[model samples]
Target: MGPFVRRYAMPLTFLGLFAAVWMVQALVLPPDARRAVIAWASTNLENLAVNPVGTMVASAFVAEGAQGVLLVVAAIGLFPVTRRFGNLRAVVLVAASHVLGTLISQGIALVRLQAGLLSESIRTIPDVGPSYVLCAALVAAFLYGHGRVRRLLALAGWCALVPVLLDGLLALEVAAVGHLVAMLAGGLIGGLLLLLERRRVAVPEKMAAEPVAGA
Candidate 1:
């Protein structure tokens, strides 16, 4: 691979795919058609309860307006995180964050609905976005962030994005909590993966240094 591609393959691949889907939604489809498509593909409580697997994948690609663009931009900026932790670890962390975040938030909403704390309308409320994955990636980046300045910058970026993700609405306050849970989950998972990788590497090294049983 070329130097540029080697350095940025992850972000470029993700951004290209996301931009293609987002552009089709923005330019090709009419507003009503787009909304219908979004509704059908959303990971809201009702939709998720019905179609958990597909919506988890679909919903990550359904950002609205500038959201999709910003997600790609952020992905590019944080692409180093992929390099730092290795692509598999980064992808797993992000995927887990998105899936777990959605499940946790919707689970809480279900409980509230059952207790009459939230409106039944929440079951069908539109909940598609790249926010969960992005939030998780950001948290993982923070964990891998090296210097004091890098860590502070990662944290500042997260704080700035949280209100936008939750839309600053009082009713959706639980979402902020859900995002926090996802971030913490990402950090924990990232740490564990790193620990496991270290142990895996150490085991072979220790065996190589030890004398053979018969030799």
Candidate 2:
């Protein structure tokens, strides 16, 4: 039990936090107050401009849709990545992807708004969710998960998420664009981490071999 908890600490903590936030959103807050909380936590253009770090970090923990399904998907996606790469790397991969995805997507929206393409109302469109982080984890796990079962779980998650994530991609919707970018970012970051891990392992093996050869 101890080892199991240590191994899955990152995913377990994230899920716990997610559930707490879900409860607050669903049960504690009234509808009007819930909207206010979500708006405050959202990574919308106005919020991002005012408080980028807070909104980006807060947004990933707030769900805008079916929380139950998202929770399942998050568990499937996050655990494999954490088990494969350890907690720090898993967090880095997902968090970096989330921030990068948000920035790029919102940057595009800003450009469009400036060019008179998007409505002024987009500045406060209330974009909050865990989808970006979950998408990144799914991509990383699918590409680099250790076991067949882990990889299959990630594949299943991707299939379930693709329709929803890519729904308005052609129209360049903010959330859709963010999810796509987060997936790509996750894959790229995963490749880099894998390379670094291989090099770290190789160096130790090389050092050990050099001592044997000299003896």
Candidate 3:
């Protein structure tokens, strides 16, 4: 197509792959099987820790792995580089970040797995850790460095985590409404910050032609 199309193609493609994989896992894997797999992986090799041995689980694991690798590529894409470098960066960033996020997520999952093994009902608590670090890296590298696209994707990404955490909190019998409210609160704060950040980033050359200005 055009330069604009080419610029985003790699990112879009990897994202699609990542989504497909996660969707398969979420749609296919059984809860019990998923727990068992997580248990095995936690006590043994980190590599083996993926639970839920169904087709969907396989798809999700592969997708998460791909995302981890792609994240690093995306980070490198932030630097001043040739067109090839931009594409290369996109791939690496997506994969690397996904891996980091997975590792963080696994750490949290391990606790639940242990609970399962012990016949306890305890589950893991939510906090910003390795997974957040991975996500932060992806966002910072893209928004803080390259400063592109109004950072909506970054903000939305964080917001998405809220819903997942809300579901977890609800399962734990915490104030379910609180979790939802927390998401709303976070949404507001995150939105404001992104808006401020968007103000500071240079309007890229490619964006200059727009009739309506983009933040």
TM-scores, in order shown? 0.85, 0.96, 0.36
Cα lDDT tens digits, model 1, 1-215, are: 69777666666666676777788998899999999978987888888878899998888777656765566545633575676676667778778888888888888788888999988788887777767777776777777755666566667778777766656335645456567667777788778888887999999999999999999
Shift in Å, residue 91, candidate 2: 0.4
**Model 2, residue 154: what's the lDDT?**
94
lDDT of each: 0.74, 0.92, 0.40
Best prediction by lDDT: 2
lDDT of 3 by residue, 1-215 (tens): 68765776665554455455456546777767545544433212233334323321232234223355444433343221213235554344433443343344444456546767422322322221123323433344434333344245444454555454346553443223233333343333334445654665556643775677564
**Top model number, TM-score:** 2
Top-down lDDT ranking: 2, 1, 3
Give me the displacement of residue 175 in model 1, in angstroms: 3.0
Query: How many pairs collide in each candidate, listed in order?
Result: 0, 0, 26
lDDT of prediction 3: 0.40
Q: Clashes in model 2: which pairs?
A: none
Q: Name the Cα RMSD for model 3.
A: 12.7
